[model samples]
Target: MARVALKGVRKDFGQTKVIHGVDLEVADGELVVIVGPSGCGKSTLLRMVAGLETVSAGEIAIDGRVVNQLEPKDRDIAMVFQNYALYPHMSVYDNMAYGLRNRGMAKDEIDRRVREAAKILELAALLERKPRQLSGGQRQRVAMGRAIVREPKAFLFDEPLSNLDAKLRVQMRVEIKKLQRQLGVTSLYVTHDQVEAMTLADRLVVMHAGIAEQIGTPLDLYARPASTFVGGFIGSPAMNFLPGHAENGTVEIGHGVSFALPGQAARGDVTVGIRPEHMTLNHGAGMATLPLKVDLLEPLGAETLVYGKLPDGLEVTARVHGETQVAIGSTLPFSVEPRHVHLFDKASGKRLP
Candidate 1:
């Protein structure tokens, strides 16, 4: 396994620039995920690394060798695509062996690699099945198996799990993580799903509108987001952002609704953010409190999400365990854990302090 590096990578379509400039590094044998919304240049970046697309500027190196000008095959990387990209007429063994055969590898060597990959993926029993005969999850595994048999320098997955059902997606996610750990390959995964990025990545690279927002370990980025976009994108239900003022290390919303900032900051206008799970609906007196009017209630098995709005028209979401008989239009108190509150510069959308 080898490291993958991107130095000021850029891409453009005719006169329009899609990817500005991105600098990223995937350590040897590490699994890194490139995540963002649609058209954020994640797939474009991956294609550039795979040699499928030309780099408008800068360099892409795999295993310390510049591969920007190398052919896709010569780059020694295998890509698992969103659609599985398997041949409908070929059997599982045939699909996994096609690349090796093209390279003119010995027949016995090709058989050994294919059989080993099939065993690793638990597809040895289904090697005779065609693509149509296999389930979505199974077909996706075959695609991964095909990449595994190549023993390439690196692996690229372009939303490979997008076509599976939700339940199977969760299951296959675990399988992919396990396979990567066993193989210990340098991999770059591109996905729009934040959940997949969080659960599968050893580290995450958050992108927005082609720019890299932040790159760090999952916990580091989640705990200390470099920008408001990272805070809002990394967590589910999103972060609740309210525009307010910072006065003497505290943020003032309205009418005695003041929250202590995480650290010292100059007095100015700032956006206060707090996660739904970090805030609770409590009727106690402390710090800051907002009287909320419940609008909706979502019961998610182990927990319930209470959606409401404050008197100042600020929307709030609070997470509570078990089912609470909270009704709509009911005004109740809500408060956030002080340390859990996040402060950011309203103008730049960057974290403050």
Candidate 2:
């Protein structure tokens, strides 16, 4: 395993820049995920690292060696793509050994590697089956097995589980995590799915408009988002944002409701961010408590989601531990997690203390 670093990396397509001077570091044996919306340059960045696309500018180092101009093969990395990309006629064993054979390894050595990888992937029984004979998850494992046989320095996955069904995707996620840990391989996984990134990454790199919004452990990003975009993007059902002001050592949310600031702030407009899970129904008078009406309720067994609008007409969401019985048109009092509230500069959308 090796540490990978990107220094001032940028990519451009003519006059339009897709990636703008991004720097990242992946520690040895770490499993990092790069995630963002489609066309946000996440895939382009991965391609640059794979030598499939030029860097346009900057340096990329793997294992302390500059690989700016190195070939993909010379980079010593294996990539599993969204599609299985398997040879239809090749048996599972042959698929896994194809790379080793191409490198002119001895036949016995190829057999040993293929057999070992098949066992790890639990594909030994299906080794004789062709690509079409296996299920979607099985084919994806074959793709991973192909990468494992060569014992590359690192592994790269490009939405490898996107083709599987929802249930299968969850199962493969655990499998991939276990396989990576077992091999102790440094990995970079890219996907548009937030759930995949949250469940699989040791560190999650959230990207937006060609820039990395934030990078941290899954819980770190969730608890302390670097910006408003990150706070809203990292959680399920997303965080709710309300326009307000920060002045007089207090934050005024809406309809005359004000809460004392955790720290000093500038006297100007700001955005308040509170996650659905960080909100609670309140019946007592409390600072920052706002009068809200429940517009809808979604029962989720363990918890319930409330969709409603604040008095000032901004969308808001709240989740309760048990299935809430609040009805539409019912007035309810609610408050945010005191320390969990996030403030952002309304003009820049950047986080504020």
Candidate 2 deviant stretches above 4 angstroms: 282-286
Clashing pairs in 2: none
lDDT of each: 0.91, 0.88
Candidate 2 lDDT over residue span 217-263, tens digit each: 99999988889988888989899888878897788876788877656
lDDT of 2: 0.88
Query: Which segments of model 1 are wrong by more than 4 Å?
Result: 282-286
Per candidate, the number of residue pairs that clash is 0, 0
- Predicted candidate 1 versus true structure: per-residue lDDT over 1-353, tens digit per residue: 89999999999999989899999999999999999999888999999999999999999999999998999999999999999999899999999999999999999999999999999899999999999999999999999999999999999999999999999999999999999999999999999999999999999999999899999988888888988999999988888888889988788888778987556665789888888887776644445887778999988978888889988888888887866677778987778767788888999999987
TM-score per prediction, in order, is 0.97, 0.97
